[model samples]
Target: MERRTKQREVIWRTIQQAGRPLGPQEVLKLAQQRLPNLGIATVYRTLKAFLEDRRIVVVEVPGHTPKYELADLKHHHHFVCRKCDRTFDVNDCPRGIKNMAPPGFVVEEHYVALKGICPDCRNHGAGD
Candidate 1:
């Protein structure tokens, strides 16, 4: 049982509106526009509470910092732009991914992240 504070609300709403996973710094930066007094400590603490309550889930891309997004979002994958270092949500997933696993291995869960030049970066001539 946790009381929802203005900071928490702002943080949650910021993440919800971002439409993609955000790191702690991104959340704090966006939340501060609404609450100038928002602190990094408060952002981290509230994120912890949110995780404990299952209000948010973590998005992990190998070799990158973890990100956070709303828990109720539908299943999806992610793509990272190597040029801009930005991550984007990829709604489409390949079928029969579970069959790729080795024998005797029960595939319970999976996360897919593709790395390439995103459209924005490609448009900017940052990548091929």
Candidate 2:
């Protein structure tokens, strides 16, 4: 287990309070609000240790950098706002998605990513 530090605690809390996955830069920016002198290198290093400890999981969206979220969240998927390029957690999963696979094919696992303008972007008239 990695020793707990203030920096690591801030980083973890940043992600936890976000209620959604956050990229390294996002984590650094949010965490810096509380720990003004926090450095990007420390954010990256802490994120690495969190991953090694299985305290977090990576959320990968096509053509975008990976983001991190807590590992203990219940099964879920993601949604990307095309206008703002922000990602949000989609807690509900469609039933029988595996049935979409061709006959005789095994569907061991899957990831669903819905893309559209989020409410904030849509309200701001950023995307149609």
Candidate 3:
């Protein structure tokens, strides 16, 4: 069993409080607000341990770095802001997605990611 540390608790809380998946850098920045001396290496280490323990899950979007989120969240998809490269959880899943596959293909699993300018970017004209 891995020993719990202040750094690990802060990092875990940061990810848990965030409504969406966050990358290592994002986790570091947010965690540092409470733990001013927190480092990226510690964030990475804690994340690794969390993953190994199944306390967290990795979120991978094509062309983007992997992010992490709590493992117990309900089933959902993701939305990536093209302009800012931010990711957010899309809580609702489209119905009949598995039926889109060909007749002979078995849809054992699926992932859906929508890429577009988020409200912040769109309002700021970043997409323009």
Candidate 4:
């Protein structure tokens, strides 16, 4: 079993409290508020260890740096706001995605990142 440290606990808690996925820099910035000495190296190392131990999962959206979230979260897709560059979880997926693959291809897993203006940005006219 991995021995937990204060830094690891703080890092994990930051991700949990974020409510959505976050990239390494974002994680490091928030974690440092709790443990001021937190370093990028430690953040990366801890994230790597968490992934190896299956404690957390990676969120990948094309053209963006990968984010991380708790492994226990239910399966879901993601949506990216093109205007403000924020990403949000998308709970439901289109039903026929698997069938879109070519014949004879067994689709075991899939990831989708929808891009559009988020409500906040739209209301604020962020990109206008």
lDDT of 3 by residue, 23-126 (tens): 99999899889988778888889999999999999988888889899999988999988787789999888899999998999898889999988998878974
Q: Output the number of the TM-score-best candidate.
A: 3
The predicted structure with the larger lDDT, 1 or 2, is 2
The global C-alpha lDDT for each of the candidates, from Candidate 1 onward, is 0.86, 0.89, 0.88, 0.87
Candidate number that wins on lDDT, 3 or 4: 3
**Model 2: how far residue 96 lies from native, Å:** 1.7
Which 10-residue window of candidate 1 scores lowest in summed lDDT? 1-10
Residue 11, candidate 3: Cα error in Å is 0.6
For model 2, the superposed segments whose C-alpha errors exceed 4 Å read 1-4, 125-128
User: Which pairs, if any, clash in model 1?
Assistant: none
What's model 4's lDDT at 74? 88
Model 2 lDDT at residue 75:
93
- Model 3 lDDT on a 0 to 1 scale: 0.88
Better of 3 and 4 by TM-score: 3
Give the TM-scores of the predictions, in the order they appear: 0.84, 0.88, 0.90, 0.80
